[model samples]
Target: MPISGFPEWLPPQRMIEQFVLDKIRSTFELYGFAPLETRAVEPVETLLSKGETSKEIYLLRRLQEESATSDDQLGLHFDLTVPFARFVVENNGKLQFPFRRYQIQKVWRGERPQEGRYREFLQADIDVVNRDTLPFHFDTEMPLVIGDVFRSLPIPQAIIQVNNRKVCEGFYRGLGLPDTAQVLRTVDKLDKIGPDKVAAALVETAGATDAQAAACLKLAEISASDGSFVDRVRALGVTDPLLDEGLSELLQVVETAAEHAPGLVVAELKIARGLDYYTGTVYETQLRGYERFGSVCSGGRYETLASVGNTRFPGVGISIGVSRLLGILFGQNALTVSRSVPTCVVVAVPSEDKRSGCDRIATALRRRGIPTEVAPTAAKFGKQIQFADRRGIPYVWFPGSPDTVKDIRSGEQVEASAADWTPPAADLQPVVSAG
Candidate 1:
């Protein structure tokens, strides 16, 4: 029986995943981001620092150990950002200022099993961190990179919905609501619980007046694909320096994206990320036609998530939920690959005594960068060809007088050299594409 949330892909589907990951990795590197990886486990207290994700963390424990000790207090990280923060704090002196890096790793969460939700999944993240003062331009740059990534993929179009914490917090503070975090959290649930429940939560939990709740909802409803959102926000009659600062910052992000990656991003005021650490710009990505699956990617800017002494490492980043995105696509039969296995050529074994000769041919092909395997048994020629056919192997090389290779599908055999014969580039590897 397979575990519900821990997904395992078949060979074809795994090929699709590798295909997507390659595009993401190549695109990240093309933009000069170095690759990085961190340990899977972090101190329990460290994971708990994010506050909202404590319940979703999976703690690590040894079954053989009788009791726990202080050193054993650890848990699997639920997200990459928290671990990245600790990594920065520990390695601050060794790294350069304004470091850029990309990480693709499996992250564990204890959320209930559902479509597009998982207990274990892969996440790809790119981030730029600065020691003291990170540039605001990096915020805009995050979405542009993400836009390039999605555009390169075979999946449906991805629209990155962006918002800023300062916008939400400043607006709430302007309404005489000091507990901005509470109000932001409630508004973050607007998409899940709807506007009515969110309004009630704002008044009941955030201790906002009914009128203040209405204003908060109004602000949440404001969205635009361009700078027009700025004027709409101004019309709300909320005046505060922080609100003005946030509005200007968000406008820059929106306008920059419009100029570069047109139609790839939108200013969505309701996108208050649930994580409390996001102090500035926040992001959420929705796949067109898959809206019910929720945001397949999300992250934000955090000014104080990592620090050592007086040094603060501020960063802006986004993470793609690789598993969730693929899950949704796979459920819809939206992706496929040319073949299940990587093997491109199979050398037929004429007889048990001739297996050694076939092995040599296989070796020669492999040395030339062609994926090849010798027949498993000294079976009949028909049976040998059948074996290759069953595995989706395209070519069958026969080691004999004037060695010939057959394109099994076309039923065409041609004389060829094991040392130099090459299949078409498309047949060299499994070709992944939209179904």
Candidate 2:
């Protein structure tokens, strides 16, 4: 009776997840991003302030509380960005300017369960915020850091597709469409609903003419690995100052990515990010051969998401869908760990009286930075060895005369000291890799 959207991993799979998280965390830290965490729950209105994700937000209510008129209603956060915005505003006076932080936490959503869509999942986010203004270079830096993380992992390559909200909005306004938000929300559905439905939605919902819809679709279709996307958009015969600004900013991002992580990023004009808070560059990532699964990582820039009266914090960020990524890799059976458990060596108990001695030896090994465990029972040597083998423990230590350790797999025994002897580096910890 497992829940459909909330997934649990086995020991080995959990190890794999931890390994991926470590890689992502180390990469974020390498780029000088500090770590941060916000509360899981926020006022329901704060959650709904960023986007039209009201249907996806899980509201909180006490079962014993009968009154529905409570003013302090809260909901589980659907994404890291909104809570992060609230955090920046609340902590404005205590923090320094140009705050760079990385947050890895579980977020709950109420979306219907399906492949790659989880009601509860882990997200790793890195954002850089500054008072009043944020530099455009921060947008370029986001994808580079993400590219490095993917490169360091054993998973398939990820291509980050980028688009600026300004480009879409400006283009729509240039086309006589007034409601840019509705147009963006419709264009964001281009991948899921196809171009025709998106076109119809643009006309029916966003008040776009057939020609404007076709032009919008054409703009959406423009994608390039390099700066060629600029000319493509220009060729559409649409021009606006804000669109020009977005084009210049987006080109810089693409060109920078081309210089550092070539072919790892592309300019995809249709990446409308849907969220009303995203006022500038937006990003979506796709793993090679797993495009149908949707974005495994995404985020964008916001100029007004974090505001407290006259003060404002503008920021740019990207979030990695940690659970979604691991789920897909685990489903494909593409990841594996050296052992199901972290125990590298198991000390055999010669007898019930000698169990205390085995524990002492285990403690000595553990002090030497080795993951050691004492055998559960004082059984025959063969039976004790089997116990170690069953759990994939590489070594079985015998705490007897001379104190020898046996490599269970190789059946090789050697006299060793608990204080001085060390396992090979590779065997010291569970190694995670692609199968």
Query: Which portions of model 1 miss their true places by more than 4 Å?
Result: 69-72
Query: What is the TM-score of candidate 2?
Result: 0.97
lDDT (10s digit) by residue, model 2, range 365-407 = 9999999999888889899999988888999998877999999
* TM-score versus the correct structure, for each prediction: 0.96, 0.97
Clashes of 1: 0
> What is the Cα-based lDDT of residue 82 in candidate 1?
90
RMSD, every candidate, angstroms: 1.5, 1.2
lDDT of 2 at 275: 75
Encode model 1's per-residue lDDT on 114-215: one tens digit a residue. Answer: 987899999999999998899999999999999999999888899999999999889989989999988988998998999889889988999998899999
- The CA lDDT at 386 in model 2 is 90
lDDT of each: 0.91, 0.91
Q: Lowest-lDDT window of 10 residues in candidate 1?
A: 65-74
Candidate 1 lands at a TM-score of 0.96
